[model samples]
Target chain A: MNVPLLNVSGATRRFGGLVAVNEVSFEIGPGQVCGLIGPNGAGKSTMFDLITGVRPLSSGSIHFMGRDVTQEPAHSRSPMGMSRTFQIVRLFPGMSVLENVLMGFQPKFPDGVIRSLFGIGRLGGQERDARQRAYEILDFVGLADRAGDRIDELTLGQLRLVDIGRAMAASPRFLMLDEPAAGLNDAETNNLAEMLARLKADGLSMLLVEHDIDFIMNACDKIVVMDRGTKIADDIPARVRTNDAVIAAYIGKRAHDAQH
Target chain B: MPLATKRASVWPVVAVLALGVALPFLLSGGFQLRIAMLIWIFAILSMGFNLLYGYTGQISMGQQGFYAVGAYAFALLQIKLGLSPVLAFAGAVAICAVLGLIVAYPLLRLRTHYLAMATLGFGLILNGVANRWIDFTGGTAGLTVPPLTWGGEALGRTGIYYVVLAIAGVVFLLHDFIARSHVGRALQAIRDDETAAAALGVPVRRYKLRIFVLAAAIAAVAGCCFSVVSLRVDPSLGEFHILVSMLTIAVVGGLGTRFGPLIGAAIVTILPQLLLQFGAAETLIYGAFIVLFLLFIPHGLAGLVENVRWTRKSAAPARTAATNVLEVKG
Candidate 1:
């Protein structure tokens, strides 16, 4: 009976003759962790692109917090409390971890570029505040000790945490993570799942596109399964796990591959 | 955590300031002072260039267009419009900033090489227009700017040099402030990964446009200083050679480092003057230095300092890991 935090209806993205995402519809409710699972090239990332306004929707619409945001640009979406991380970790490689996270506090710069140029705005107080917030987020993501290290010095798992830390610095109400568990060891994956659960407990909504089956199965409140740009299943994880279409789309292929 | 390290940066600022103050008096010779002044102006130019290329990672081969606009605006505003030299300088920078903003809308859409070429095209058009507009630009013969005067007394050579020095000092401080501020971090973030910056709410396109305009405005300020120093405005200020030289200064000094542009500017400005005795061989040697810097020390001289610091810091971690062994030995 409540408006979803993020709603997509018949969202489609076409690349020339190929339909990357075709008439896909889903909704992620407030404080809910919705898992988007699909085989490779099932338009999972493309769906994120449409949601974040990184790519224009060929058809249909996306509404965030019950308002139409399909026409907005990607940068504008963040101020509205929508932040995301890339499938491949996208930390600012040249910057220290603190500096990278500090960049996420951009919305707090109310005076914009003009006042900033004259040295009137963000002189000391705002910078200190941002730095404090950056460290806090780093601390939250277990990267507080490594805040001074350059991104290049970080291991892949540490870099992934840094990405999440930067995203978290934006203080988003809804976070979209594209394959956050990829390339992470089992312990790191569990660590991420625990972090996501804690974020959820704090009433943050999340849309996670991941291939880590056990991680998603254990963590997500609901799971939406996509196959070839179409939604095959959307329900609570317990029911969705038993659905025939979901099983055929997932385990059936694995079983067939096992035969080979 | 590194409060002691923070204090280290202050010494360099003090040293540069002391050097800036003492240079004019120490030089004494007019030609040497002229070279110093030129170095200051080009340093300002390269600082602007670094803001765009070094921090934001956007290359503009069309900076000379903005430079020429500044120089000509200063000269023409004084000569034709009868404005004061100082007022003309301000007006020129303002005009260039506005022009930069106007150009950014269409220009910033092109990424990397295309953006560079688009800017180059803009500069070439400016050059052609300056050459053809005889009535306005004096058709390559150029316009002579009246000596900067206040209360009917000319600034003369030394006064003009000091005026430039003061302005250049302000620009340096402003550049340093931006480099250390949240703005500098934002620009560097955009350079590192634009999409990620946007996702973090950096207003990527807007910041890009602003930096482009800001860089142009600074270049215009440098051009205004050049006009005052040379007292001449010519189409050559907007030529391809000026763009290449400015790019060279930015690269050779070290992209993005605080004092790299200033050091690069000094080397670039002094090198040709020193090589005057060697005729055209000066250009050959200049080109060779650039090649060598690019090949061996790609981060420029600033990068060399970073490497030294890195090596020193790198030793500490090794010692920390071997602390148990040291304890046993002790």
Candidate 2:
């Protein structure tokens, strides 16, 4: 496909005696939304960790935008146009939603202790520009009105959206979302799906790890089915839905037989 | 992100500065100006301390060590080398700043309580040196110096107060500007969550190192000022109790607020003087006050002020409470 944006081959991760993700392989192309889905303990989170450099793989290679990032640390990867959201929404506390997003653009902020103290070198102007852009990002995520709200003031659904808004503020060419739909109600999930559609239209590539199989089926351009640390199926949503292995993995053999 | 917050903060700073200038003239007692100087000195010292512990989230328990060194360095230079007072002050500040860098490079590598313990040890070591190194430090009896002078002229109580206030005022303004800057935002992010801050490419160690050094330098300046006012330097200045008192001011003033340190400095500095009769139980009172501030008003006086402002702003019951939450939390 189109000189894949990310190339993963035989990505494996082991925790002591446990093989968490065993030789799973996948790729996502330019402007494609790839969904990684599995039941609990299926190594979905582990795979996300490996790809984002949160944890190093026991063995495997991760190439993002053509360069290998397998050895890169988590912090270093964000500057190379890669951004991620944690499953539990780890945001900067004691900051407004707007400041939280502004923090995402910290790499762009100047490293000037003296300059900041003196209010020199267009410091105020730079912050003004960053704040303006942050507001635009908030608007893009449909949380423009909640920009001034505190972190604790927002609901769980809104907090997830704020996390996405923060992720987008980094101006990443590629984005990774870990359970963006976790703990979301039907309405919140639908809102998230719509936002993803808009993001794709904006020409941003994303890899989302999610548990809502129906939402994944609806939102992904391609789907990777993971079951117990193994890549069971990789195909378009319609085809992956009908695959016997996929049905068998989701609902055991007896349940699969009843379903057929 | 509008200037509503920025614009609103300017007036309080200006008003406070004006009060500082006018307070000396209003005082009539012989030692009243000294009390004001004490407040001014602590406010300046705690501003830097606030930047380190309050803003950067690196709680240090060894600052009194730096303060003692600063006083000793300034006192020793003037007394031993017979250097000019102003020059000695500058050299003394530089010396402690270098020490901060040396200590922070190794110590800041440890997080939270470990770093705190390392710093406390550093302070204790310096204090021990001051006590035992009799030839240089004059032992626990201390080394007395001539009165603080600028150029060749001696500064009186009023002159020193004005000079200290001017310098302290400039520092306060810088602290205000910093609290509003993007760098301030980065520090808060570092405080809130280091991993997340680094994910945004915040150069976490560099900022930590910088703030630690800055705080140390300020503590040194405070020590230097103390020697200038008292005309002596001793081991007592670097004691553990002094550091606790310093911490109390930072907490009581407000951890991260721009004006918190100054308010805390005033409360802790002045309250102890008011209760001078209870000299034996001074540490006991400090412990009680800190525990009270922590249990009931952990946010300190700054939080109290913000709450007061919020209640007043919502007198008409206008914007949602959430708006004010961010305005103050930010």
Candidate 3:
């Protein structure tokens, strides 16, 4: 499979007696827009956390770019071109959007604390470059006008876009988005889907967790369905739509009537 | 969006600097000059405290530990090792920075109240060591500091005041730069949301430690200056009362605002003198003001200014935005 961009195997997590995610495994090939969809509390977000190293798996492992990174910290993964956004829309509210994007770009530089303090580390030159990159990312996300705005000034949709902008600012090879469309309106969702299409055209791989089924159905090249933390189906959207287990677990019994 | 586009005003900062410059001239009496010098010394300490507590949102009640370390380290290096005072001060700052880095690793793992308690314990331990280490520290009696000299000539009061002013000026500029730099943004990001900051590749723990060390070094320098001013380094330098007062200065001035520490230091330092007519009731009144500030102006005086500025343009957006920012649990 040309060494999938992200590889997960036997991933499991338990909170006491509850098996939050149970032996789920999946992969996303290069340039693929993969959607992870399931009923609420089906461990979709937990899977994202595990892959990004925000949480440890009870068993199993995650490999990114052909290297085992299950034991690596979340911060360490970013410089290796891995980035993800929170389901809760976390932004540094006191900071402007530009400053938030600047943080995403900072890890790429090898500036040490002493160098940063002394301003010899291009507080002038590198900062200019960072500012330029931040502006470009903001423009790409259609937020160039509000680059100076605080998080408190953004709408829910704008906040989600800002999150995406921040995630992309790292120039990651892989992006994992958790419920990016939860509170976005239809127009906003369409805007997001368009951005995802643009990103896919640029040959970036994505694993998106969204409850917006139609958006997922239309936007994803491949869909993975999960039920009770296990992968119930993984295939092209067309085939996954008709898979009996996927329909039963996610699309409902009425979906079986239509399939028959 | 109201006034979000406006640059934070610089006039207030300039005015404060002007007031500081005018202080020595405004107060001619030696007693009042000593009071003014104490204010300046505390202002330095409070500014260092703000770097950790205000900007990074870490509550540390152990700053006096660093202060005491700076005083003793400087004194011992000068008197015992016979080093020059300047070199000793630098050594003391280095010592405090190293200690801050060491302590931060285990202590910073705790959050909020737990962190506060841990830092309080750290201060207590340092104070205890100062009290019991009679051979090295002279215990409760402490060590007398000689007047800072240049080429065997003692730097008189004027020279010393200028020296303090110059060091404080450098510290202020250093702090201002950090606040505006990418490092500052990273620290603020960590403060706002540590997990998110980490996901964004902020290296959260390292940033916290760096700030802690930097703040500690600044506090230590302030302590060196305090010893010079007092002509002694007593075990009481590391006492919990110093921690409480430094915290009160930061809180009363405004937690995260620029120039807050100076304002807070001035108020806390001067207020006690103002209340001397009330005799023993001075502590009670001072405590009452702290309570009043906390209850009525939770954001401190700086927050009050921000609120006023926020409301001047459009109260609606400002009101909602204030609540949204405050709603952040951490």
Give the number of the best model, judged by TM-score.
1
lDDT of all the models against the reference? Answer: 0.82, 0.81, 0.80
lDDT of 2 by residue, B32-109 (tens): 889888988888888888888777778788889998999999988988899987889899999999999999999987
Q: How close to the true structure is residue A211 of candidate 2, measured as C-alpha lDDT?
A: 86
Ranking by TM-score: 1, 3, 2
Interface C-alpha RMSD per candidate, 1 decimal: 5.6, 6.4, 4.8
Question: Candidate 3 regions off by >4 Å?
Answer: A1-3, A10-19, A109-112, A118-121, A251-260, B1-29, B274-292, B304-330
Candidate 3 lDDT over residue span B1-330, tens digit each:
432333344456556667767777887777777777777788888877887877777778899999999999999999999988889999999999999999898998776678889988998999999999899999999999988887789877766776777777777766666665666667767677777888988788888888889889998999999988888999999997898888788678876667677778888888999999999999899889999987886666765665532122122223333534553521
Report the lDDT tens digits of candidate 3 across residue range A1-260: 68998888889988778888898888888888899988877788778888888878889989888999989988888889999987788877667788777789868655545776666555667777888888899999999999877677789989998999999989999999998888888899899899988998998898889898888988888988887777778899899887877767664666445334
Best by DockQ: 3
Residue lDDT tens for model 2, A98-194: 8889888877766747855555667767777888989898888888888776676788898998888888888998999999999999999999999
The 10-residue segment of model 1 chain A with minimum total lDDT is A251-260
- lDDT tens digits by residue: candidate 1, A121-147: 445777777888888888898988887
